[model samples]
Each structure stands twice: as structure tokens, then as C-alpha cells.
Target: MKLAYWMYAGPAHIGTLRIASSFKNVHAIMHAPLGDDYFNVMRSMLSRERNFTPVTTSVVDRNVLARGSQEKVVDNITRKDAEEHPDLIVLTPTCTSSILQEDLHNFVERAQLEAKSDVMLADVNHYRFNELQAADRTLHQIVQYYIEKARKKGELPEGKTEKPSVNIIGTSTLGFHNQHDCTELKRLMADLGIEVNTIIPEGASVSELKKMPRAWFNLVPYRELGLMAAVYLQEQFGTPYIDITPMGVVETARCIRKIQQVINEQGADVDYEDFINEQTLHVSQAAWFSRSIDCQNLTGKKAVVFGDNTHAAAVTKILAREMGIHVVWAGTYCKYDADWFREQVSEYCDEVLITDDHGEIGDAIARVEPSAIFGTQMERHVGKRLDIPCGVIASPIHVQNFPIGYKPFLGYEGTNQITDLIYNSFTLGMEDHLLEIFGGHDTKEVITKGISADSDLNWTKDGQAELNKIPGFVRGKVKRNTEKFARDRGFKEINAEVLYAAKEAVGA
Candidate 1:
């Protein structure tokens, strides 16, 4: 059996908190003294909200953490929450209370009664814990407790007079690194005449929480949250869900087919192949760009991937066959799907290294000595030490995927971006070689060895013959500035006393 762990589900665009906050029925009561790193964690995790102010809160002081300041914790717990008094109040802890072993469970219980709130409290603390487990525990607790209570009250969420829709679960926590994928998936689904009734931690509101029954099935590409959320949706609404990463041509089309099957069974006549065909154009554009022979010299590029398992799988598979890159080492710091990753690795690479932690990944990269790496921000530290260029793929993620859909990672444009960024890094290193060869000073000693401050400057006939060979990033900056150099002024084109005066004007 493939053992899958539950990764923490939220902290995604953190739009889940926002979605909850908007409902007036949601209050995020954090169980930590004010000294907790709320600002930094919130800053690092979510993008949409700055303060998380109206919806998010923590027990007010730092002293409460180590010393268990119950009085202060209770005082801070008093909430005049602006919504429908919240049918459910989610309690999460910061590192302080989590470490101090404070009685947050009782604190929440008493607070509910004292405040006379009709809401239920849930503990969602997952920091300093593994990702999937973090999200899994919280979600399982919520779903099971909700189900048991509803059974007692004879009010099951799925006991409904509903139509049909597919739920897109697992957004907030795990796959939150790159939201463009989710956005593109949504757009693609809509263009194909599919309705996504709920996208948990993103579009799924508490009001819609019970409406999850309306969803005939679940579509999850982010495996961690998908499996856990699928279990929840199945138990509560008896909804069966498919867990798959909607990446690559085959995987993407397969997902559409699975949803189409579910929809057809539910009586929705949709052309799944046509939808996949329409979407193939988006994926194909990137295939053409990335698989182009311009990179034939770079074919069989050796690479090591270390980051989220999902992202590692995606990049390694397509990158290997499409871009002709070879994956020598593959690993992950976050909890993820290894079986799925292994399947891709087996095809794309000769050897695949998998890990659930960072240290092991660093060790693997040092051993493999691959030419390039795609990794988490933390792994970049290791890459820099090893003199390798590592692009951040997962956590400590880069903000380059901004404005969502404007990033083409989902469709053809995304593949193009990948090819462009990777190719430019190496091909652009040729400038120095060209300059050293043509710009005089042969015999390898004067040119490649070292040039003194007093060394006279000279560009041979071959050098002057190639005046404007600069490319890309620094091209415009150098184009306008190069001629201003004294050495350029002394050339035959502008031979003047001003040339000598210009060189003397500044000691270069």
C-alpha cells in the first residue's frame, strides 16, 4: 500500500482565511501569546491579506506562552466577531503555545461557553510539523466531528436536493506555491462547460461548506490535500474523488476524461475529448518551444530537482523528454506523492533520489553534481555553496508567478517560460569568450591570465569587425555606454585628439 501523509492544507494564497473572513461566520483564533511570529508567518505564507486583521487573532501576550497566562488568554479570546457569530471557530496555535504545551483545547472550550457563542472551535496548529500531517489532522478533525454531530442531529450535509458539480480541493496549503496552475485549471474548466462549485481554502466558503454534497466528484492535482480532502468528501457526502496532478499532456487530458466520466454518469453530456483537444493547444505551444532543436547542443542536460514532490515530478518529467534535460537526482523537502514521482522519474532519469527533508536533499545534490538544479529557496543555499545555479521551485517560493493568469505556466506560454529561462542562463555566458578571443592580447597569458591596471588597451581587426554582438539583459545598457569608453573612441571610426583626451580624462 502507498502510505500517504496529510500535509497542512491552508496557508495557500491564504485566500481561504479571506473567504472565511468574508462570511462573517469565520474567526481564526490563534492559540499563541502575542510574541509568536504571526507577522513573519503570515507574511511568508499569504499574499492577499496584510494583517488578516478582522478575521485572524492570537492570544495577546508573550508571557502567556511560557508561563501559561490563562487570564490573559481568556481576555484576548473574547470576540465580538462581525459575522453570523460563526457556526464554526477554527483555533490554530503559533510556535509558542505548541512548544509550551499549554492547555489550548480547554481554553477554547471554556471560551465558547463563556462567550455564549453557538460556534464550534477547531485546533489547526501545524507549524513545526510535517506539511500533509498538518493539514490532514485539522481537516479530519473538522470533517469527522461535523459528521458525527450531524448524525446525532439527523442533518447530514449530503442529504440534499442538489444538482451536480466537481469540487476542486487542496488549494490553501500544499500547492499554494504557484496559484497560476489553479487559476488556469479553473479557466480551462469553465471554457469546457464544467462547473467548479467549490475550491477549498480558496473559493470554498463555510456557507458552501455544506454544499460540497452538490459536487458529484473531486478534482485534485495537489496530491497531499487531495487524498485527505477526498476522504473527507467521501465520508461526509459519499462523493468519490480522483487524485492526480493535472500537468503534462497525458496527465492533463486524463483528468478531463475522469471528470467527464463522472459528469456523464450524473447525466451531463459533455465532450471530454473535445475539451482535452481544445486544451492541448495550450500545452502544445510550450512543447514546440521547449522541444525546439535550438537547445540540441544542450540536449541531455543533467539536472537535480529538490523541492515539493509535486513540482519536482512535473518539472523533471516534461523537462527531461521535452527540453532533453536529464534528471540525475530528484528529492523533496515537503511531504508529497513519491509513487507518482517515482513513475515519472523511472521514465525520465537513470537514478532518482527521494527525501522528505532538506538535509538529505542537499547531500544528494553534492553527490550527483548535476549541471543544474530546480529547488526550494532553502536548497539554493546549498547550490550556492556547491557553485551550482538552483532555481527556486517550491517553498520559500519566488514571486515571479505574479498576477496569476498572466503567467503562462498552465498553457503553452508556461512551457515557453521554462525553456527561455533555462536556455538563457548558459547560452549567454559566451560573451566573455568572444571578447577575449577577438579583443587582442593572444598567447592565453595576457588575456585569460590577468590584466594589470596599467595594461594598454587594443582591439584587433577581428575585434573591431564584431562591434555589436551583445545579447539580451545588459544589451541596451551596454549599447549606449560602450562607445563612451576611451578605448572605443581611439578606434579608426572616431580617431581624434579627443580620443586621447577622453582616455586621460578618466584613468581607465
Candidate 2:
């Protein structure tokens, strides 16, 4: 594992906790040390969740380790059962606890016999999977288990609804605008004469999960999170699933037609052209904006995108194919999905990056010098350092990412939002040249000589005149660095010699 101060993802157990925390009436029982409970702080702080996150830590303190005792795990399970009375309780272990070689699954199964609730022991092999993979696997296992149970109970519905229905899978607590994505998807499906049977893993009850197979098909928007569950339902129960994430305008239109075609095969007639008319294009500004003269400002502008596989590929495609921006570099931290991401971005990017190291990504950004950046919050810092504007399109997000408005990065609304964000982020038209040409003449006093130099260090008239020769784009940076250097070195005022020395010192 990389020993970095920051990481793109948490450990595997945190992923399992995300699945357990997302749904209603489900609790997670974690076997870990006391410090491992810090995951709760992350959820509470980042999501600002009003209610307590549904997770109980079976604290394995030094005392328990010294005595080799595991009675605390059973006690915690019993306590959670008595207190929460959850319909489902998931059991998992942290990386440190995994080394104990304790049979966590067997223990949870036995505990279920004594408790009133059902328990699922998520057997996540930390050696093999990361956060997103673990989440996908755990959710899939729970979905299959509940589907099987419902089948045995004779609760599986026979015959489909009059209108075709689809279940939306893979929306979790920390997913990218998950609630808004679901809302947009429901709106789109409702417009197409299709019914939404249920949305899973977020605010879904165990009963809702059990009824997922009743839908005519499944819509797995996120490949990293819900594709496995959708594929399993299709293969095992013969329910069809459509794997497409409606990101940009073109992709969103394609996804709508694909869904229509799939349902049309099941005998529901749909005219895709009728839906993809001027009305649909009007729903997203990007469609018209791409052909407008304002878009000419973005022509040949380069962008570097780095994030999860889904957003990275989608943004790369939209930047190049839709908004007329050039994608000079595209990459992701999701290693498992690298091959698929590489294939998807082949037309835009010559090479695809697949790693979790922030330093490497920062270096890549420096090399590319993109006009705009689309990535996680870490990349935002890198862009700011390089004086490039960054629009966050993926996870490892900050509180600022969770906007209160209906900003989505999916469907028609998402295409609109993405295009607007890109337009606002990059330098438009000849603004930089205008600033450089007219910087020094109009703004004096404050702009040129607002503050008097100190007595000991003075700016000679020639040095001041020489500083004005620099372009406005770089003058501010040079001035700040020179001033900071003089302040640090006990210089009262800057002279010509000191100014040149400071310039050389700061690599200006």
C-alpha cells in the first residue's frame, strides 16, 4: 500500500460500511479497534448526516488483544440487535482485524440465531479489492441473498406491469449526486412511458431489495458500484439490464434510445426520434451551445481530466466530442476499471493513467498545462497551484461538493451543468490578452505604487519602471513573491539590486 498523506479511497471495510449505512433499517457491525470508529466522523462531517450513521464498532482494544478475547463482538452484536432492532445487520472486519484469522462470518451466523434480526457477513478480501470493488461486491451479495429469500417465501411477483418497469441500482450515500441522479432518471423514465419499480442501496428497505426482480429490467448507471448486481440479476433470473451512464447530451440521448429499444423488444412501442427532438435538445443547453459562436472560445483549448473511471471517461468524451475542447490527458484512480476507461477514452487521449498517487497526478497536470481540469478535490488543489481552473466531477469530495441545489452530473440536467461549469472555468475569448495590454495604464497608485517602500530598502525609479515591463498575467505573482522575500529577509524596502536578487531567488 502507498504510504501517502492522502488517498483516493478508504480501506475495503469502509466501502462495506457505505453500503450498510446507505439503506434504511440496516446496520453494520464492525469488528475493529477503537480508532477504526473514526469512519463515523468522516460520514458525519462530510455528508453532514443528521442522524447517526448505522454502524457499531466492536472495539478490540489492547486489553482484548492481550487476552485474545472476542466476547466483545458478540456483546456488541447483541446490543445492536436490542437497540436498533434492524432488519439486516452486516458484519465486517478492518485490515488489522483481518490478521486475527477469526471466523467473522461463522460468528455472525451463530449470533443471528440468538438475535431477533438477520445478519449478513460480508466476506471482503482486502487483499484483492479496494473501496469501490468491495462496495459493489457487498451490495451484490446482499441483493442476491434477499432475492433468493423472497423467492423461497413465494413473494416473487408473476407477470409484469402494464407499462415496463426498471429498477435503478447502485446509488449509495457518498455517490456523486446520487439523489439528484435518481430524480433525473425517474423523470426521464416517466416521460418515456416507463415505470420505475424501485431504487436500491439508498433509502431502500430490505423488502424493496427483495422486490427488485419484479422490474422488467435494471438500470445500472455506475459500473463500479452496481453493474455486478445488475449482471447477476440478468444472468440468474433472466431479467435484462442496460449498462449506460447518461452523462453528456449525446450519451444521454443514446441511453434513452437504448432503453427504448430494450423495452420495445418486450412489446412496448417507443418512437425514439419523437423523444430526441428540439424539445429534448432544449432541455440541455450543451446541445445548442456546442454549435454556437460562443463555443468558438473553447476551440482547441486543452483539458486534463483525472478521477474515477466513469466521470473521467465521460468528461473526456464531452470535452472533445461535444464542447470542442481538446483532451490532452485523461486518467483515473480506479485501477480495476482502467482497461474499460482506456477503451472508452481512446479517441480523445493517447494514454490513460491508472493509479492512486496524488503526486504523480500533480506532475502530470504540470506537464500538460491544461486550460481546465476535471477531477476530484485533490486535483483542485493541484490546479490552483498551477493557476488552472478545476471543476470537480468525481469523489473524494469536500463539503462544497454537496450543493443544496439540484445540480446533477447525469441526464439532460447533468449535461447542462457540466457544460456551464466548463464554460465558467476556462479563460474565455481574448480576455487574458486584453488584461496584459491594458494592465498598467489605467490602474495606478493601488496597482503600481499603493504602498511606500520602507526606509532601509527602496525601489529605485528604474527598478519600478522595469517591473512595469512584465505582463499583467505574471506581474502579480512576481510582485507577491518579491515582497514576501523582502519581508522575510529583514529588508525595509526593495531596490533594483534586491529586486533582481529576489527575482532570481524565486525563479521568476
Rate residue 154 of model 2 by lDDT. Answer: 89
Flag regions of model 2 displaced more than 4 Å.
Answer: 1-4, 428-508
**Candidate 2 per-residue lDDT over residues 114-229, each given as its tens digit:** 78988889988976788899999999989988888888998876666677999999888877777788888888888887898888888888878776777888998888899889
Q: Give each model's whole-structure lDDT.
A: 0.55, 0.80
What's the TM-score of every candidate structure? 0.71, 0.86
Top TM-score prediction, candidate number: 2
Candidate 2's TM-score: 0.86
- Candidate 1 per-residue C-alpha lDDT over 394-452 given as tens digits, one digit per residue, 9 for 90 to 100: 55443443334355344333455556656654354354456555774233221110111
Model 1 RMSD vs true structure? 11.2
* Candidate 1 residue-wise lDDT at 419: 61
